[model samples]
Target: MPTPATSMNEFLVSLLRVPAVAARDVDDEGRTLVSNDVTGSSQLHEVGPDGTWRRLTDLDGVAAGRYLPGRRAVIVQHDAGGNERGQLSLIDMSEDAGPDVLPPLSPLVHDPAFVHRLAGVRQDRVLYLTNRRNGVDFDLVSRELGTGVETVLYDGGGYVGEVEASPDGHWVVLTRPNAPANSMQLLLVSTLDGQVEELTAWAEHTHQSTPSWLPDSSGFVVSSNAGREFTAVVRFDLDSRAWTSLVADDEHDLVGWVSPSGEHLLVATNDDGAVGVAVHPLDGAGDPRPIDVPPGGCAALNRHPDPVWSASGRALALTFSSPVEPLYAVRYDLASGSLSALRTPGAPAFPPGLVQPESHRVPTPDGEQIPTFVFRPADGGDGSVVLVVHGGPESQSLRQWNPIVAGLVAQGHTVLVPNVRGSTGYGRRWYSLDDVRLRLDSVADLAALHDWLPSLGLDPDRAALYGGSYGGYMVLAGLAFQPARWAAGVDIVGIASLVTFLENTSDYRRSHREREYGSLAADREFLHEASPLTRVEAMRAPLFVIHGANDPRVPLSEAEQIVAALTDRGVPCELRVYADEGHGLAKKANQLDAYPAALAFLAHHLAKGDGVTGTVTNIKEDTE
Candidate 1:
């Protein structure tokens, strides 16, 4: 990444100032609730019916909230200084409250030491998951809105993930890891009784969605791939204990949920890197009607527990973005088939000649075709190439809006985004390829991508590796393991030593992360060999590192040690740490500072001649 300069170009500043809506919730009255960055920092905002904007929570860090069913109150999840140990709070949105701002967050579930994730909302109660019991096992708990009373619904053995509370409040369907890192099991917990039952035949690594209830509350619908490769929507009936498939595709995965009226289901199909959405009838009698939106990138759902439908179930709201556009929120009406923006994200303006993503597959050494989304510079290919890795080794690189990639293209850097092995949205087998000791195989995918870049008229030696979290780990690993291929690298909130990261990370995360990265107890030797710090001696590419001081996932020390080791070896390194961020840069001011400098660094180092290296003379660290 580039170090800081006194000023940034006008186009880059415009790119940084572009606002986006990440997620949203729609109330019964057709009002929109969103977590948008128009306020500089991401906070909760309500878009009223009359085109007026109401600021909800003015927290320094990001505030995520959702509308409670049929009520004027909302449940907000907030955290301190980006530690990610979220606490639940309620803000009164009743008529008595001022439109200027809602009341200060009323503590609903406040314990800084524990993590409380809000799962689903019902009539007068909210369901959530917490680790407050033993700090290791997560329990399913629900709280009343008026009385503030609590009930621990399910405390099964251990490892409870996200769940769906039945509409009638009688049952809750659960999804959790069933030993294997890439697998999950579907279970049902009776809210009225204490009994827990497996929802399906026992199978390891079976993937399923959170259940969507039927109108009568007898059974539910879900997308599961228990006995097949591609996902299909299956309906389970409690009376007969029979399963029936409603919607499926031979080549693509069909994921959807039933509408409030149970008349139709909004189904999304994943084809490679593009998405297609449609509405299917529950009877499986009619053809699926396609939705009219952008062809490539569209999102009908968001992070909130609320359904995308309005209270009346007549309107559907979704947020959309692509490589050429920033994230914007929109609504679709069923009867009218009309689409409108809830509120235009920021100004919706950018430099002219923004480019679209081109889908390609780079062949790997092991003969696997790695799916990649490449963005070319509008000014032609006079500059260098950058390989942007998506984090979550579990996550795929979608065709979504990215300010960094757009800015780089504007500056003449062609960006290649690849979904290597171990990325989801493909299939179960593809998702588990790099678990534990197979970790280095994914790093080898990056080298193969660089080797194949020459086919597109790009120089393999002039390429750079850029990513965050797991992708950041790839950046450092590429610079170290394949030192001759890359001219520079940029890492953000990534891991250096898997062994140290597993040991120093938050206590609640160690066991969960151990499933992805090898466990220290059994795989210590392999962990050391796969770590970038162990091979830091061979890293010669100029490197830039960015991290949040309070990141609970990847510790700040991961950044400190890697930069220190490289500097001691006389390799040029620069580090920028955001004191008030975690995981990644959250606030716009910090991003405006960090990204510009990182881009400057890439522009300098990648322009060097053949075997011309050491782009920086001295190491620089910014903690201010």
Candidate 2:
């Protein structure tokens, strides 16, 4: 048993101890290769059929690991610190040798200056996307595993998203996102001639992704929001260019993967914020059947380089978690439709009966409904509230495991996580609602959330805004734009100025971010107006800003400038900079330090009332 004063930190430590399967792939022998954080940082791990786990790589930042086509070797992607400029290394799993830098067959293919993303692995050939030739956009390239000979497949500009090679090795499917709008186009490229054909025509404000070729190679299946309000799994015929809706719903956006045999498809739908899994037959003769997944957020691991189905097409692997549980890797049997845990990692069972969030629809001033998850203290009626806004204005606030939310609730604070307009789980129209100049409407949605706090028996004046990345930007916007609302704010790796962020971010990410935040060159004035820095003089809340010095997505300057401005005005502000981290805090030690400081800051500010003001006290800088 623990008191409220120490339970938050204890819970934070326990949550950090629970390891998560970041990326997973299956070998022919049925062994599951996973990337997890069992040893402080995310590293490669191999799980046997008997549920035994073995460490593979001890690298600092192993983002993901995938078994090669032959299964004897595994290719792992890692970056220095959290910089995002990743490099792929080949590890001979059989020999238990250290990872070796994949020798480049063509000097042009492996340039140290650019980031290399493993697209797909075929028989003795590797397909990847890189921005080596052009600093801005990625071009698809293929290389021979043995000779390292490389050839450019698609040299087109724009952001090249996920790429999948056909089972028969004749064709490759790739997605190119047209940013600022949610529109993306899929391309079907022939391996023999390097010719590319547009599978989905340019439709304004539409999104298409996660393409898998049919076993016969005559067509492919993809998740598309093309003329529909929500994304649906649709099949496209290469010859006739005919599109057929395979699995669709009026409410949920469907995402799925077709089995290698092409007889069945495993689809996951974004039903509000929770994920639901179902298996559908491709013959179209029967209704789709639902698979019983534990009540939580479920993600299909079928998109990995390895086969989704076991060698016998009997079992499939997936990762799942809930508000109380951390992430786990499980295998689902097709015959009995039963899920067996492969790897269940996370904090020990939360002393049963912890706070379970309830879903609510908070109505905005414009009458648009915003879906939110509210976590109340077990004893009930905590006047203090924390609004946790999610990043990726395009992403949703799902009912997933969050340490901060759990910690806040344990300490008798009510927590609200909202998915405002421009969030994806809602339909396509809802996703595009916060694009470009209309971005502030999402901020208004936050203000609406603050206004609704009182109805839940929580004090609006005692509330704080907390978030990271884009969500961090929202926190600043809420504090500055809605000055009188919050008592304090915690912005972790958030962007303060959209213009500076777009200008200073990685070249490959600029255009895509510009699509979401508006281009610096074109929308300069409008972007400046929307920036949190522009309204620094209006901030009434005490602020705690955290950032990674190596953050490539949202540069350190964003935090520095805002903190400097707030401090210059004689406002209460604290700044924490982690030297070895990029974007968000990935290291456990860093998180332990940062999260505790954040919780303490919120507790201190919320207790003093919204009118309390003080001078800048402490600024801490940490390095690995």
Candidate 3:
């Protein structure tokens, strides 16, 4: 569970590789090892095997919780400098009564020049997938933890993105992209000889996500869009070269892990609009036994490692949020089948009547019903409002902690977040709604919300459009495409140019871009027409742009290019590029800086008579 602490939207959720359960002293330090988002200064402490957790580091950004091969503590730090670049750090908590010693493992891997993807650590060597050596692709490099000597196993061009090492570290799963349209083929690579074996053929347009190795390490499980509407679970045998489907449902299913007990496999499934965390058996059989946990909703389960076959099958930590609750971390006991809360630093639950988000559906111009989450403060039904757009165009807006919305609500403003069109969890039809040409539909749906806002007893003139990634792109679309609609906009790591965005993204995201935006080479004119960069001359609102220098998904150039254009046109715009951040902010300081910057921008533009005026040029480096 990320942070079962009553505060939802304290952070946003992403699909990353997380260990199902972490080993901690149950009697002393409790179960959770680190906070939800892997922030660097993450009060990241762990209960020693003897039952006590102590603070490990005092630096800024830290995350990517990797437990060393033989250590009882986590060993990776994310963006320690608030520069958006993650620094490798080793946290030693083996001592029962003292503060953990955390030392920087290597020079920080900052954006544009260096991007680190934590692969695996064996013996005293740490393996990382980095784009530092090659500008276009990633390379597997091994670094000795003590001496910091680095060795390249393979450059990213031949093999795929991050390599998944087998249990005994004898094999690795590599993702290979097929030509013509750039789809992916999952392959098994022999670590000793560097031999590649094709596991999944690129026969269709479908793709593969993170693949987890079974405890035996001889076989693995991958989430793929094989048969059903959503992604399905498939178990692959390395020796037999055969594959078996675990479960075929209309919803997408994520492989939590092959249980430590090997008897029950944890799976998070999106059944219709709701998500369920269930336990399934191996051997392609049995009905999925749903584990009763939480306040009746959940997603993103983090599993534990080691103790090979524990009676409890390790712990399952997940984030749960629903209509009645905000997002919080909840740990499920595999042995006792119990759920408990995990800690979050300063965030607290929204006081009752302070604000409550009501979920509803707004009809698009084409008769499509879009899901929307509206947060109204207690002061009055009428207040300044903002439309928070979610990224992905392919991603959905669930009931969770939205800092921007929550902050606005605290400042006596109402907030509206719409699932819009092309969001997931609503089936493939909804996801396909944001495909290139239909991109404007979701942007239009956001605009339509303004008309619906008044009916819900809100003010439209007090509205602003805020989003990151795809949501960032939508901010530009809403402002430039219709100049007078929004008073301000915030674009965080958003796509400004479809052509440049595709051309500049990392190899790992190449295939998914096609799945969402279509091919730039073939749809050249269409991409240019839809890109926000091409229409910057039409923008009229005050704009705020934040991007990570190392973002492989959208690239820092996206933000630079757009901000430069807006500046060239004399449009009011503020651009911030974190030196080490990628895709999203992982450091708490970055979060602290980002959230306040966004609030200040919105307040300057839309808040009633706070009266702080034009061209305020205060840009200070965040030291938090």
lDDT, candidate 2, at 137: 79
Deviation from native of the Cα of residue 127 in model 2, angstroms: 1.0
Higher-lDDT candidate of 1 and 3 = 1
Per-residue lDDT value at 456 in model 1: 83
For 1-624, candidate 3 gives per-residue lDDT tens digits of 122222322322111111112222222223455444333333445433333444555555544455565555455646534333445656555554444455434343335345576676565777777666554466777777677777676653643543566777777776655541323578777767777666666565455655767877878877776555667777888789888887667645454456634566767666433566677777647777676654334454211121112223566555555434445455566667666655443434334433446768887677888877777766653467888888866566765444556566655567887888777666556766766677777678877787787787776777788888888888888887877667888888888988898888876466557656777667778888888788888876888888877676888888888777877776778887677566766555566667666777786688665322356232424332
TM-score of each: 0.94, 0.94, 0.77
- State the local distance difference test value for candidate 2: 0.78
Candidate closest to the true structure, highest lDDT: 1
lDDT agreement with native, every candidate: 0.79, 0.78, 0.62
Cα error, candidate 3, residue 263 (Å)? 1.4
Ranking by TM-score: 1, 2, 3
- Each candidate: RMSD: 2.8, 3.2, 6.4
Candidate 1 local Cα displacement, residue 258, angstroms: 1.4
Candidate 2 RMSD to the correct structure: 3.2
Query: In model 3, what lDDT does residue 329 have?
Result: 51
Full-model lDDT, candidate 3: 0.62
